[model samples]
Target: MNFRDYLLPADSPRIAAARGVTPAEYAQRMLATEKAQNLQREWQTLLDEAFRGITTHGKPQPDLFHLQDEGFDNTCAVNAARALLATLSDEHHQRVCQPVDAQQWRAWYNPEIPFNDFGVRLEQTSVATREAFRRLLRSCTSPSGFEKINHLMDANHFLGELYDLTNIMNRWSFHFMIFGEPSETRPWGWNIYGHHVAFCCFIIGRQLVISPTFMGVEPNIIDRGNEHDAILFTEEERRGLTLMQALTPVQQQRATVYTLMEDPAMPPERFNFADQRHLAGAFQDNRIIPCEGICAAEMSPVQRQLLLDTVAAFIHILPEGPRQARMAQVLRYLDQTWWCWIGSCGDDDVFYYRIQSPVILLEFDHHSGMWLTNEAPARFHIHTIMRTPNGNDYGQALLQAFQQYTEAE
Candidate 1:
């Protein structure tokens, strides 16, 4: 469907209502809605489950992740972190830094407005500090990974321009915070989140884990003819659809968990206003999402390779070393992996699909518009999540392993 057909005029009631209000005021107004309040209550209930972490069944599978030296550039990452810290004054430093295991790591939410204001909002920071954080990002991610992330930030700015809402969705609207001290031999991390982007990276020695990552876009492009123009998720969408089409008719039938994006037969919890068809989005740290759809063990060699390629599209976000390590873990657990789909896989259709295994949980969903006015899920609006399940999200499992090793020593 053409998203332009769904665009809300600047003077439309919704757009007009949000205009001129500060982002905080808009957040308060949005959060005060009965629907938003209900979501918050439900999320808090999930948060109280003690964070055993994401699992297929109720219990976490043990030894799914182990600490090993992967040759990550931890020294460079630490140096970048120190540079960022050096740019901050004492007061700003205190606010932007936290312990490695800080609870605020789980508090990141993906919306334009300030949600709790827990870190240094890039828009409010000096240029030097923002550049330092960019260097930190470059240090931790592959070159392509870094570009994709900055592309999302630029897309956010374009959205703000689309609605004349720079107060809320500008490129620098995100929050950047460091966790733990800059140490090559100890665990530490960083978080950057705003609008449709959120990334939490945890590092321990030469091992690195970047999970509980959320990247999405509305309209999926910044085509106003400028340096920031981008069209996202093309490969991610194409690869998944190709895999689905490659399956046998029977396999396709089994892999399709639902026949429609908003299937009436789904349980009430299957879809929500904020997360749509994604069960692992913000605040779902310990959700017990049972495996659905066809197993990879059921695939032929050709189709199986297609499946791996599909997953690699999302896994490419990691630096080369960490990407290799993560893919190895995924390959090791191939027999236990599941691939599931919602809605048709037609070229023009909007849909959602997931790849889940003991070591990973990846979700990509087409969503109904929020800022624009589309009332149905559209290909142009997308949300994708990557999580290391069975207790590895936010690298909590790795952190626990580090603690155990330290105690034993």
Candidate 2:
């Protein structure tokens, strides 16, 4: 169903009773006017800002993988890209292909609201075409990583069928775009984006970065399904909660916000501080947020291990070697990393937490339901994101530094 359909008019005594507001009040107060407008503008302004210094190069960047000697083997990735190119018709290519530097790469959203999707949609194409795209995705990500992503699509479809809103919420509603040529020696990437999920897989030589990645869902459990009962993201949710539970009372005082995920019964400052929705969500590719909350250096050995394990839940999405390399970098900076929490620490309470380091920014949140009837924040509706900060999203910052170093040499 269209996102707006869920915002039932708070006019009927029944509806009004649910939201605790009148019809006119429901329409006005329920919508996120400023945030939505900001997201729209972020898309409009991305090309000029996040990618400001980019030159108009139609091919992949030659030196994009200069620092890589291990951790990536793009044979499968290259063959898959070529296979996709060969399989697609000219009309499909024209519809799906985008420039390597297109701002479209930065246009990803996981909000419960409906938005337009670019590139090729799965349902609009032939079965062969859809299989080719899946092959391309599997070629790039780890087996488990790919499974998590695919299951999310299935869960979306399951919800669609349950609600009889399959038209707007089908599993095959995703879109795919290939930027630059597919070559093992150069930089090229692909993005598959749709409701509740978005991934940017950028590869340069044996190196890859999947940043600005988004994975979220409503009704995170499937009680009635036999075909695909997806209980996903619970590890991520549990690991975060474990760390919070392990923290000392003094540490809890340092991290807790004394607020709930829902902004109700709170002042504007609280919502502004933690955000009415997600803080480091999509369209925020260029945020320059500094570290906040407690640093890892202050944590005991057990807390540090818990922190490392939590980071692994996000980093393990990469292929084996890259995953190891990335974790090494994370370990190197563990002392510099920061962890913070917002809302109640109890297991039953919905909350938010962020894990930040020089190279990583991870956010896990219990969100207010948009599809389900729940009004207060619930564990069933969740939003989680992983970003490579300091301009490395899509590996732009790393490529730039590599370019400068080569010029000097």
Give one digit per residue, the lDDT tens place, for model 1 in 228-334.
Answer: 67899888999999999898889889999999999999999899888899999998888899999999998999988998999899989889999999999999999
Candidate 2 shows a clash count of 1
Query: Lowest lDDT 10-mer window, candidate 1?
Result: 40-49
Q: Write the per-residue lDDT of candidate 2 for residues 1-409, one digit (tens) a residue.
A: 2223343343544333224332234334434468656656655675346452221122222332236654687899889888888878898888778876677887765643344456776667787778888898888789999888888887777666655555556677677789878888767889877768888888878888888788887767654548667787888989999999999999988876545565466555345422344556656565545566799999999999999999999877788988988888789779978998878888777788889877678888877656665566778777788877656677776556556766899
Q: Cα lDDT of model 2 overall? A: 0.71
Question: After superposition on all CA atoms, what RMSD does each candidate show versus the true structure?
Answer: 1.3, 7.1
What lDDT would candidate 1 get against the real structure?
A: 0.88
Count: clashes, candidate 1: 0
